[model samples]
Target: MANKLIKQMGLPKSIANIFTARNIITAKDALSHTEFELMELLDVDKEEVTSAMAHVSEVVCPPCQTALLLLEQRVRNETLAGHLPTHLKGLDEALCGGIPFGVLTELVGPAGIGKTQFCLKLSLLASLPASCGGLDGRVIYIDIESKFRSKRLIEIGINSFPEIFLKKGMAQEMAGRILVLRPTSLSEFAESLYQIKVSLLQQQVKLLIIDSMAALVLGEHECGTSRQQALGVHVSFIKSLAEFSRIPVILTNQVRSQFGDESRMYSFQEPLYNKR
Candidate 1:
């Protein structure tokens, strides 16, 4: 029966033998060859391809494993990952260490905690020369709060690299790399963000900033069923896009109050109100 099932599933005889010995219930329960199905089987979310190689004998494929090895190498190459500073030395150092290449890092805090400043600083930082943090990469700044300030960025840029502004050629080059985007509505904002991400990658954008994500959510509607649903969609959209781009997505968020508990006297709320 196992032999018949294995033949039907088109698996190699040697691979099928291993399953048959374990008395594997059926081929239906085994891994699939489709891309999505293979992704599910590998549990790429729970564990990385590199970690899986630690126990190569346990995994099901030689060809698939080889493909994963190549994929893993590519990811490692792109990541060129770095560490977060121990002192939390503001945004410059925190990101100076490096933001996860293909992950969403939320900057949630109170009104005056420098969230916008961080985003602006990151844009300028990414635009700097090799001597600075720049990888010859550009930045895409999405202004949701209507608080995108050019003056503030200029101030930070001057502080971080006075020589650039002092030198017209360098300043012109750095200024050209930044792309400021302002979307009037939530839908427009989302569409623009998607396009900007795609476009920026072509220009080798290492950093993308969405200033005050909650503003767009709250601007469209108050916290309600519709708003909740929309926010969820936005979160998922950003997460997916972040993974695809393999670039740092620094998003600012707003805060809200929460009800207090019986045991704890303090009443705190989640600053970043996204469902996840």
Candidate 2:
């Protein structure tokens, strides 16, 4: 009966036979083996590994194996998949026709550039009806520096969709769909990430906005530590989680003037983008 699950997944019979020969026990256990990892176990050549990968893709839905061809297909899928529109014509056009689902988009600028306002707008716009250009799904807003503005969210909602929210309690329902998190420091942000990993998927969070990604690491940089490297780890974790869950993460970052250069600026020493 366990073998039936493998067969139902559209994998070849020989692959199942190979697993049984190795005493792999069940398809669940066998599924964990990558094509490269399976070489020693199966005593197989590269061609056999390719064949195993093909079988693996049958059960994995999207293939776990990374190849140039697979990556091209993944990019194609991302472009074709439905995206969350920010509901502004020019901004949407600038953001590749709306924020692409399943990736991180960094909004970097100096102070007073409306990053928080944009985030608030996104949270409100994310919950509107599809006819009015919204995802109709919940949002996860991770605020740092005490900057998640609910009053602004309400104003944006009431202004953008007066007809919808005016119909009694719809405003609160819209507000309820936005799940807000205030993480004061780096450790708190990390803890919040763990708590939200499953919730994002289970609750169908369509958008994630991290206001001021640099806020948590500010103290570390002041103390002359490896704050850049540390920030990379944090951003990488958030990026992978966002990508894996197919949710678009909007991160707000603060810019710093390059030391001794006095001409150029960089975002968190380039670790946030370059390393990841």
Best by TM-score: 2
**Candidate 2 on 1-276: residue-level lDDT in tens?**
234344455556776577658876555666678767777787777787677666655655643566666656655666786567777788766555577677777887777888898888888777876676788889989888788778878888888778987889988989999988888778888999888898887998888888876767775476434776777888888888877888777888765555575633235323242111
Residue 107 of candidate 1: its Cα lDDT?
Answer: 73
Give me the runs in candidate 1 sitting further than 4 Å from their true place. 1-96, 258-276
TM, every model: 0.63, 0.67
Candidate 1 lDDT, 1-276, residue by residue in tens: 222354345444554554456454354344323334433554444343233222332333334447567656644653475322212356334344455566677776667877787677777767776665465588888887678777777777777778776776666677678888888889898788678757865778867887866677777886466777787777778777777777777777666653453221111113222111
Note the residue pairs that clash in candidate 1.
Answer: none
Candidate 2 positional error at 5, Å = 28
